[model samples]
Target chain A: MHTLHVELGERSYPIYIGRDLLNDPQLLGAHLTGSQVVVVTNETVSPLYLDRLLAILGERALVTEVILPDGEQFKNLETLNQIFDRMMHDRHNRSTTMIALGGGVVGDITGFAAACYQRGVNFIQVPTTLLSQVDSSVGGKTAVNHPLGKNMIGAFYQPQAVLIDINTLHTLSPREFAAGLAEVVKYGLICDLPFYRWLQEQTPRLLAREEAALAEAIERSCSSKAAVVAADEREGALRAILNLGHTFGHAIETAQGYGKWLHGEAVAVGMLMAMELSARRGWIEPAEVVAFRDLLRVINLPVAPPADMTPGQYLDLMGRDKKVIDGRLRLVLLRGMGEACIVDDATEEELVSLLETFR
Target chain B: MHTLHVELGERSYPIYIGRDLLNDPQLLGAHLTGSQVVVVTNETVSPLYLDRLLAILGERALVTEVILPDGEQFKNLETLNQIFDRMMHDRHNRSTTMIALGGGVVGDITGFAAACYQRGVNFIQVPTTLLSQVDSSVGGKTAVNHPLGKNMIGAFYQPQAVLIDINTLHTLSPREFAAGLAEVVKYGLICDLPFYRWLQEQTPRLLAREEAALAEAIERSCSSKAAVVAADEREGALRAILNLGHTFGHAIETAQGYGKWLHGEAVAVGMLMAMELSARRGWIEPAEVVAFRDLLRVINLPVAPPADMTPGQYLDLMGRDKKVIDGRLRLVLLRGMGEACIVDDATEEELVSLLETFR
Candidate 1:
């Protein structure tokens, strides 16, 4: 078992990663401070893990279960209200602790629910997918999607703890597992060169679902995220680097309609676009773009934007992204293999020309 | 103008109280950091003050006005979505500042909107009603009512500055003016005996809308609230005392329907019930209760719960208030004229008897 602590002063908490940690009652009990608990999971995850969690909680605390329908499209204010309605209906008070037991959608919405439930309450994350375990569950960025944009309505609320059980990854579909790898590669591309090289060398082991390789990957990703969050909790400066492909990724997600394309898949294509733009600006060699593209291809991730999406549509959708400040779009472009920088000097003409290259 | 600072560390802000302070551009501009602004107001207030505010803003910044329907009944998540829809439709970015230009409903929904819009944005409160000026606009508590409860969904998001224009009180109806006085008297009853005595002496001046009396009353009320908030920002311990009559007050608001009873009016009757229970517990002399009741009667505030409400209804509704912890109801009762304490030991049987007496 490996544990990483996110240092946020009073809001600080730990990330527990290992095999079958969900079955460990002692680990879960240490953080369940209240006499009542509300476990928010989705239909997909509930059928698999709800009873196991209930068994661990066991007669000690009054428990309420809310099972939402699964998918990114369900991550909206309407679904968020369902959690609120169920908790309020069952008389969950301010002292109740909420446990999010699914992937990114479940984690984001539940964490946000905890933040707004009676002003605020304690919440723990039990991520059941690779994308969530590596990125979404670590930082306190909790939000739901809006029709106009992705993650347009949300809060930066930290969780009490994050429990990651590697065994859960065994249940993930191959496509979903590869999608999560998009984010895992992101950490190395943004800040950690050695980790990137390590990922390149251990691709076979990682692909085989070897326990040691997966645990190390999860630990390294969370460590990188925790350090960045501690330094800039609200994304004032350094933290914005973490959203290297997210601005473009969000544009794809919003334009394509949420749930149609998995978040990791959009981000996978978005990262390639960022690298291509970075090459055009002479910030990085074009060879690096090909190298990253080759790695993504081998990992079974998408390397190009959808054929139907045009430059005009990309420009229009990207304009409304959260990264736009004072009418200027800020893009997180790669300066090198292990470096990312926020650039706002990219003009619309340049963006159009860049998008035209994909055609 | 009288300026009071709410000491909340980095989140601290100033509360400016005086007659017609809303017209002061320098005060408003000093806090507005961005060149884009969104002014959220209601139909009732837009025709009255929105144009005047726009004149002060001039053509320096791009402004988007969102006019919502008036009344507490509209203070729900559905109405909150209207603000989000308008902001997104207009392409308002994170750099835009939100200005709430109406009463408590506008301030609250706007504040919560600011708190959630792209994680958060800057917001200023221009409170046009006495009720908002004295209470909701000062505290960071921002929320919308749910179907089951009042203020069931919200956040503790502070504003950049609170602009209180006492002159707006001149346009308030007699009933609305009296509702505002309920909160003013609350400050005196919970922590300021001298202020209570002064209010008693200046009743006629206050009722007559004398500018001096109104300014002094607002200053005192904000000072008391700011002090309590600074001591405990999240209602941990010291701040909970500030909800002196809110537990019972929220119950009445939820049971009777939101717009049916103004918040302060419900709180006025709730305070009397609290005093009755306080006297029954031997915490204060019964004469003090009568004295306070007589004062409320003369001031034109409601002195009893709604005649149609039953004891069973009170228990059922109050049990769901935000003040409840682990299924135990916590009520803030007066220990004396100027001292308030949180008590959780009050029996349900005693509460039933207390409600019967009111009937």
Candidate 2:
């Protein structure tokens, strides 16, 4: 078991990573504030792990479950309202604790529900998918998607604690597992060069879902995300670094119509475009960009956008991104192989030309 | 002009309280962060003051307006989406500033919209009504109502600045002006006894809409609310006192349906109920309750619940309030005539019997 604390002063909580840790009563129980609990999971995840958690929670708390449809397409206000509907119908109040138990889609929506329900309530994240375990669960960026853009409506609300069970990763389909690796690799690209090299060597073990390697990756990724979140908290500046490939990634997610492409899959191709932009900026080595793409491909992740998506479509989509300031698109481009910074100076013609080559 | 700062560290901003101050561009413009500005007002207020604001905002920033329906019935997620839809459709991004123009309902919905739109944007509160200028515009409590309870979904998102124009109150209906005074009287009841006496002395001037008395009332009310909000931003403990009659008041509003009985009118009756509860608890003299009711009556505010509402209905509704903890209904009851504290030990039977008397 590894315990990593997200040092956010009064808002801080620990991320517990290990196998079969879900059965650990102290860890999951410590975060539960009041007797009334609502476990927010999706349809798919509920069938697999809901009973186990219910048993773990025991007869102590009056527990209820809201099982939503399992997909990013359901990650909108309408679906979010379902969670609220259940909560209000059951009369959940400020003291009631919400438990989000599923992948990124579940965690994101559930976290958002917790944020808005009664202005705010305590919630815990038990992220199952590798993408969520390592990334979304650790940072408190809870949101639902707007049709205009991904995560267009949300809050920077933190949770009481996040408990991860590596055992759930065994249920992930091959494609889903591969998608999670994109964000995993992102941590190494943004800040940890040694972790990048380590990941290059640990691909086989990571792919096999080997417990030790998977745990290490999740911990390191969460640690990186926690540090960035702690520094900025509100993404005023430094925290935007954690959004390394999100500008282009959100564009892909929105264009493809969320749930068509997994968040991590879109992030993978977005990272590639960012690297290309970094190369164009004369900051990153061409060899580094090629290597990054090669690593993604080797891990069975898509390294390019769909062939049909035009530069104009990408431009139109990116213009709606939340990071845009005063009509200028602010992108999280790579400074070098292990550094990322926000750049808003790129012209439309330059971005369109780069998108042309990528497509 | 009177300025009262809601001291929330770096999140703090000035509350400018005065008459005919909407045309003061410096007060409104200094708070705006970016060039793209969106003014969120309601139909009732748009024709009255929107053009004046548009003129004051000038050509320095690109401005747009989202004029919504008038009334609290429109203060829901569906209406909130209208703001988001317009902003997204217009390609408004994070740098865009939102200015809320109207009464409490507009300020609240707009503030909550600003809080959620791209995880928040810079927003200024341009409160038009006396109720909003004295109350809602000062505190950072922004929310929209759910069917079950008022303000069930919302955030404690502070605005960049609050610009209150007392001149708009001239257009308010007689009932609307009285509703605003209910909140003004509440400020005196919950904490400043001297202000209560001051309100008593200035009843004629206040009722006549004498500019000096109205301004004084607005400033004093805002200052008291600000001091309380500053002490407890998220309402962990100290801020709950500010709710005073709100629990019963919310039930009245929800029962009657939003916009049927104005918020302040419901609060006036709720304050009487709270005073009765305070007397029942042996904390204050029963005579004080009558005096409080007399004051509200003098201000043309309702001093009793609707004849149709039963105590059982009140119990069912108050149970849904956010103040409930661990399934217990926690209420902000008075410690004395001018002091308030939260109590959760009251029996449902006692409450029902009390409600039977009031009804």
Best by TM-score: 1
Worst 10 residues of 2 chain B by lDDT: B55-64
- Superposed by TM-score, candidate 1 places the C-alpha of residue A57 at a distance from the truth, in angstroms, of 1.4
Clashes of 1: 0
DockQ score of each predicted structure, in the order shown? 0.86, 0.88
TM-scores for all candidates? 0.99, 0.98
How far residue B290's Cα lies from its native spot in candidate 1, in Å, is 1.3
Error of 2 at B257 (Å): 1.2
